[model samples]
Target: MAAASAGRLDPVDGRRTSGARGERVAAPAAPARPAAVRVRPGADEDLRPEAEAALRRLVGRDDAVLRDDQWTAIHALVAEQRRALVVQRTGWGKSAVYFVATSLLRARGSGPTIIISPLLALMRDQIAAAGRAGVRAATINSANVTEWDQIHEQISNGDIDVLLCSPERLNNPGFRDEVLPRLAADAGLVVIDEAHCVSDWGHDFRPDYRRIRTLLAELPEGIPVLATTATANARVTQDVAEQLEITGEGAGRSEVLVLRGGLDRESLHLNVLRLGDQPTRVAWLLEALRSTEGSGIVYCLTVSVAEQVAAQLKAAGLPVAAYTGRTDPTERESLEADLKANRVKALVATSALGMGFDKPDLGFVVHLGAPSSPIAYYQQVGRAGRGVDSALVVLLPGEEDQRIWEYFGSLAFPREDQVRATLDALSRGGTQSAQALETQVDLTRSRLEMMLKVLDVDGAVKRVKGGWEATGQGWTYEADRYARVEQARLAEQRTMLDYESTDGCRMAFLRRTLDDPDLRPDERCGRCDNCGGSTLPAAPTTEHVAQARKAMDVPGVVVEPRSMWPTGMATLGIDLKGKISPAEKTEPGRAVARLDGLGWSQPLRELFASTTPDGEVPVHLRRAAAQVLDAWDGLQVDGVVCVRSTTRPVLVEHLARGLAKYLDKPFVGFVGPLGGHEAPPRHDVNSAMRLAGVAQRLGLDLTPAASAGLAGRSILLVDDRVASGWTLAVAGRLLRQAGAGAVLPFVLAQQ
Candidate 1:
């Protein structure tokens, strides 16, 4: 039986008045069921034979049996035309419920089931699974742009039983204006996968998911909608359930049929192996992966970390590769296939590897560090032990975890000023692409796009063919709501810390965190390292530790040049636009290390701190900088030019002069900051404005002696740090025009 709502977590205001996210509404009373939607007490057996057969086909097995609640959901959606929300564990047959419903509805001559899937991997897996059940499915995503025309034709001709799309596509101008109306009119069933994302209270809320409310409101009444998710607390569930409740005739103020099942995973063996440093933690991972059985995933918290871990593992002769948001789409697909087929030992990945990756018999999941929330951790570790008897799930918490969390927190909600600026810019716009809008607004391209999406959902802006324009509709940024969301996030982080330190049953802890009412914290699973004994070694051997430390300490990262100028620079009143001329481009440069990497970052952070006294280069960093120069591919530099740092002028100048003296080259004067130049704002603004700002501020007013010394001579450009690389590029252009032969850029760090 489904569990009843056990109230909510707590109110941010210390009162029961406001619900989750400080929403000023009560727990929505369960909506009355329509009379025609009633099912008898023994109606679980009423699922049609064809539906059961379709279920078996969906799982690719003859003995697959439908869970009672799964049957209940299928019957409700297929027969009674009622909306439902399925909140079950990851491996629970949520997809089966939707697929069976789609098959039954299509067999009865309904239009194609339109599923709003979250990821391309999820959609790919779902399409394959649907094909196993003899269902023809096609997807329209960025990856499949060329096939969209054929897919749309199939939808129009009723050749497709199902259509899958990403949430972001709902806001695409062409899709929203031309195709969505017809599809909404004809869509038989609307299935929302990973539906927890619809609520801001959820861990991975995307503003685009909010667009579904409009889709729901516009859908003809009585068209059944299904929202499914594996990770949700009572607040998220209640929030999503309220959103799923459609309004119209036959709706009758009814609530979604929320079927939240048990979240316990018997196949998982959880453990925490606390090690002292990054090297020690990495060593533990290498040893554990060797001892563990079958191919699995090693999860890292950041892209750089993932790459570092993957490199360390590969050096130890473990077959591994890194996967993150920056991975190419085609390469991501290939990596997924390789993992499914056990071609590699593990894919060291970020959160991008989670959600909808189905590798049955996968052996283990190891974390280089702990996620900030237990819900997110559970979702990731759940990827393991799916089709196996037992899978090892271990976390190696690092000291840097909290710092990473705070960095991500900064990106949560844009400042009110940024939002207003975006709205104001759009008020006079015919249409402004995100790049064009960046010139008028002070936010980065990615962040501006994110804000615009939220605005689109709020009805303050509308995306058109060329770009986005103001709708002139009034919109409010709920300060309390955002504050409550932040509070909830902090609470989640605290809970995660508790989970790491807790001595109780690990499975019970995860289940309770998900608001599973039946969970007993005292009940021991006799599986986790806390309940049972740990199977991992204490630490890596001394020799292995030394080797790992040496490998990780290897420095020097390549800084790729900016090949193309930022689009819409002309709109910003700059003459520069389009591709940067090849003659002006500098080859990929070198940095001592990335500002976020494990090797030199700690000391670099101390050096770059605002409170630290700025002066000449530190002796230790000077050695490292010399090593970078020595490692460079013998570029014959005739002069050393420094990019003046307003913040780190002394450091930049010292490094440049020292390098020039060491190489026995002339010290080309530093590029000085011109008047009317303000440093780029603390926040990440667009590339065009960043370049424009740098172009206006930095100038190379060379003396006659310096110009005579630089004519036809190669220049080695130096900077304390390289962010956006605009300053270096602009400086390089000036140096080349001043008769320098070649400009090879170098920086102390890349951030």
Candidate 2:
């Protein structure tokens, strides 16, 4: 999967990749096919000798394919000693980490390495790579037309030491019955690739991931699992650690290694352009394709759109190709070949062309449209310049994308009752594939797909290769995946609609959520409008403290420059009565306004300006907010405090623990309706919920809500938003009437 750094990526200054940045990179010389492999634990050790010998013979003859950090990461993983989740980005030799572990382990003939890859494509690629490296490698997938005997023979005889399989294959009864017994009886190691799929909270959710923990329950106690992904925030890493049963003294850790420092490829330019007209956007896109010249991917929101765009480009005489889930498997195969061979100059695709889709010569990655999440954006664009000279990662959008998304969202979205009904059927009928939907529901395949996704969020049904199957959990996902896409659309729309669009740094808007305490903004490489020769006039940062300038007869707040808490939810801070973007309208004051709208009495209305303008936030307030809120409700919380919990543990653990902690100490817990104006539904929870329960065993006495002396305790009410204080009002009243102290309400920095 990796190649040596040669003339592959010609340096900008006629040098090597080792310049000021000391960038390390190599294009993939070996190609891969997406084939699945399934292996159960307990495979015989006798079969591994050949692979071990092959690996031992190769190690000294060939230099290690991985980097120092990569080996450290893999070593930590194999030893089950990693402290944090390691996020190995593109071109960082991630694959080599696992491969090296395989090679070394096989040399000692430790056991079969059971790698769970997200796609067959990546597995085939790895198998091919391992085979080429002299390690015995193969796959297990439904697509494997080989007889079950052939599959079993490889494992029973220990002929295959490295096995590649998808979560689907692992979850199959046939695999557990026919294949697992052999593995359980033999020595094996578990590998989880694209590990982020374990998080439905992540931008990419594969239902099979949820059951990985259950699937491996009976595998092996010390069986080491190497879970790898290009991007994993703290949350996803924790979820994986928990699901994989990772422990301090075992083969997994409590945290992800979070490899954040990588070559940023500043050589590559990032740009976003908004063209209002579809035809104009199309014209500009094709124009860029013809003139900009490089292998690139054009991502559309849908399969049909990708197909259409490819058609238009092909008609225009560009060497264009298209890929979608609907693409015939044979055609998909041919297209990948064409793309790698440089026969095709460009590929228009949906999100289907998954991980390890390296086409290094990709001169530019033109996001013909916006994707649903930053994760998706990172994945799609990260594909560019893997081992080639740096290239442009561009986002060309327009009002049309919003129309497309909203139209689809409005239509693609299924009713909650419809989802509930589907779950009811699944519970009654057991697992049902796409083909069986007609018997269970009257919805068409496409509609069923939307509903199935709704069910996925609701945690009611699981989506497998075949179709929707019910899980015991109720449908709870309301985090709209489509929201990010359309929200991006509308937020951009809001910018364009208001005159403020002309003066702000668009990059600031794009990366507002992204910050590195280690880095600062520079106007030259400014990559933002304020410093560059951009057409848009630079607006003051969201919390600029300069003199007010009147525009459209409205006065700027003209507030002194005041620095916000370094550790608050967002980078931007705005004050009350200040003109703001729609995005920032739901901050503290906005929440207060909403509460006022709901007929609540306000004890305080104004906040004083901080004396140290634009300095570290006053230690008193910052410490108080973070110290209490960090472990809010006795949970480990970090990052921008979301309006509500996104992952289940956030709600089940953090929310409950925090509330319990507060209630035990008589702190106020505020609950209310939260709006997804910025993000769309990822799951279908209509509102966020936080509950508390404590046992005497834990030295806590948080009893039933009707406990005595509850009303005398001091409480501070907190919620992400406050349009309706139904949760706070009800819970607060209940707690008070049950007997505690005064409740003081506080909201985070709201606009």
Candidate 3:
């Protein structure tokens, strides 16, 4: 929903009708008071009636009344002015609690409520919902920079009742140093949606959410705060609650009301289908989605998988769209609207579409691959069956799921040495961008930025306009705590595996994993497949399986050559900067498949496993490489040259020889490392560092015969894999500088 224009509250009925969508919805008239009346400050009378009227207006239904727990949360925020955490299931009116409380608080002449929402989707929904409740709402997020000035003006003029911003915005230099101080001083209430993220133990922990602790600490006493989420277990709940606790006089912890309800959802029917392979799973999904009742989501673990699945489904005459992190923001909104309106069958999505997407009548949710943890699985599945009588939730577990989990696990908090390196870099500087620091540290760009955010939250570093600077504050690594977090994460992964194989009720297992306080040991959700409540469609036809396999078998991903040299290369004694000379640049290249692709992923993963010994290229992969070359219609390669691989030399050599023979081109000698310099470990490092090492260590090792024939000959550069692309780029430049006409890179996989 689009944001409502700033408008004043109606004096007669307290409803804001100006600039809102459609006609103003009217609530049922109260007997001795106005419809949707607000409670006056210090009024000893009960506030339930007024709250009920407000709920009616907010939901646009005269029959809408506050649930007992909703009323309890509202009362605590508006009347008692206490901190509260509402751990209710999705669709339990969590948003209503905050919206109604905003209404009540604004009616009592308090300042506008500041909502620290997590996603742009959530902010849009909250703004639309607030407008329905006669509360004027405006947002300040990355998507609406032009509107921030106006929104701030409206807030100062008391024209808006609720202000929504993302958690990341809270620590932004401008927002933190300017807007937040006033909001903290005069805000009526602060709402932290998806509060579980504030805890490191949560499934989707974000360092940005930790900034909320500083905001909470800055708020004055009696400025009621509310934290809400649907996926927190006992541990996450306690962690978030402790963060919500304010320090009283003498540094004592203040009281925080904790409201946690049962997590069981009767409308959800959970099941797991262990399809033996990716092709079979795709076939099953294709068949299942065809007969599903209503529109829903098909979740994949990676963007590539989501896109591939969506393409497969669409090719089979299904109306579907792929939604992933790489999707454009405008396209995301349009796709979401399409899904909500049932214009499409289902959205093949990654976890990017996980939280804050509201579609009440979603009929089913199918997982193409299992999420890493049960908590994450529960959170994603909770998106379905929210406002419907029943929704089918199925998990198609894959063997590749564990590998994806381990890949993400590798991105956890950096070791003490890495953290200290980052701090040391910042310590010598006025302000150093993450890119500049990357030249000094071994961490990747994303990991370095994440560490910077965590340090900013911990007060060891401060983010400024240009970059970040040290705060001169001493910090510790908290080794024991981080280790425990890692152990907990592993335990969660094991529990998720157990979830797939458990013979008991699926819903009950999820509840137990989440530590549902109201769960009974003997409880079983009769709606699950194990309870004989419902069964999925019959197995997919053999024809369908064959079609899926054929579709996925077509594999070739374009490996775009890197055009610009990475910044700060000069710091490593390299003079290269800005864009590479087009004359020396490699043409667009091809990889047999992505390391995460659906068809070739399994074989590629096995081949690249650390424990696997380097050997000849397997016959199947050799044929796959031939297929890639055969599909390269316009290629004109005179020879093949291999980049020496420190780890997989045999495999790389075999791949190069096979490609050279397939192309019927002369086998050019390898581009081996310099004698006195060992190849650097390029994994997990930034592009600059990777390139620096590659440029310094690698040199052309062609024989004098090959060198004499190299001029004006196109070379097919072969490597086992291309990760940072720096290795390929540097090798291609060397070939071009060696008088090769054009260098075309061909890799086994793109990592």
TM-score of each: 0.93, 0.56, 0.93
RMSD of 1: 6.5
lDDT tens per residue, model 1, 686-709: 787888787777789667899887
Candidate 2 lands at a TM-score of 0.56
lDDT of 3 at 386: 68
Which residue window of length 10 is worst by lDDT in model 2? 689-698
Better-scoring candidate (TM-score), 2 or 3: 3
lDDT tens per residue, model 3, 1-751 = 1112346332112233243332121111111111121345654256777887787788776645555567767887887787888777776678888989999998898888998877687678778878988999999887788889899889889998999998889768999999899988999999999998999998899999999998898888779999989888878887887788877662332657777777787789999998889999999999999888999999999999999899989999999999999998789889999998999999999988857888878899999888889998998898888667789999999999999999999999999999999999888755988888888999989899899999999999999999999999989889999899999999999999999998899898998887776668889989998887768978988998999999988868889999998888888899899999987899999998998879987789888998889899998888888888888879999999998888888899989988888878889998878987665456778778888888888899999999999999999999999888888888899988999999999999998
Q: Which stretches of candidate 2 lie over 4 Å from their true place?
A: 1-16, 19-65, 79-84, 146-149, 180-187, 247-263, 407-751
lDDT of each: 0.81, 0.48, 0.84
Residue lDDT tens for model 2, 1-751: 1222443322111123432332222211121111112222432233233333333343333222333355345555444423323344555555555665666666666777777777655566566667756668877765575655685687777788777777766556567556765675455566778877887446566656765665555565555556667655444555565565544354432333434333244434556666543445566666676667567778877664576568666876889888888887667768877877878887888777775675556677777666645545655666777655556666766434554555444544455566666677778767766544433444545566645654554456666555557779644635465455345444434443331233454333333222211123641334433435323212223222111111111111111111121121121121122232222112121122211110111111112122322222233333333443433342321111112322222322343334445445433232222343223222222111111110000111234542443444544444333322223333333334444444333342222
Q: Which stretches of candidate 1 lie over 4 Å from their true place?
A: 1-37, 40-48, 676-683
**Largest lDDT belongs to which candidate?**
3
In candidate 2 the C-alpha lDDT for residue 131 amounts to: 72
CA RMSD per model (angstroms): 6.5, 22.0, 7.2
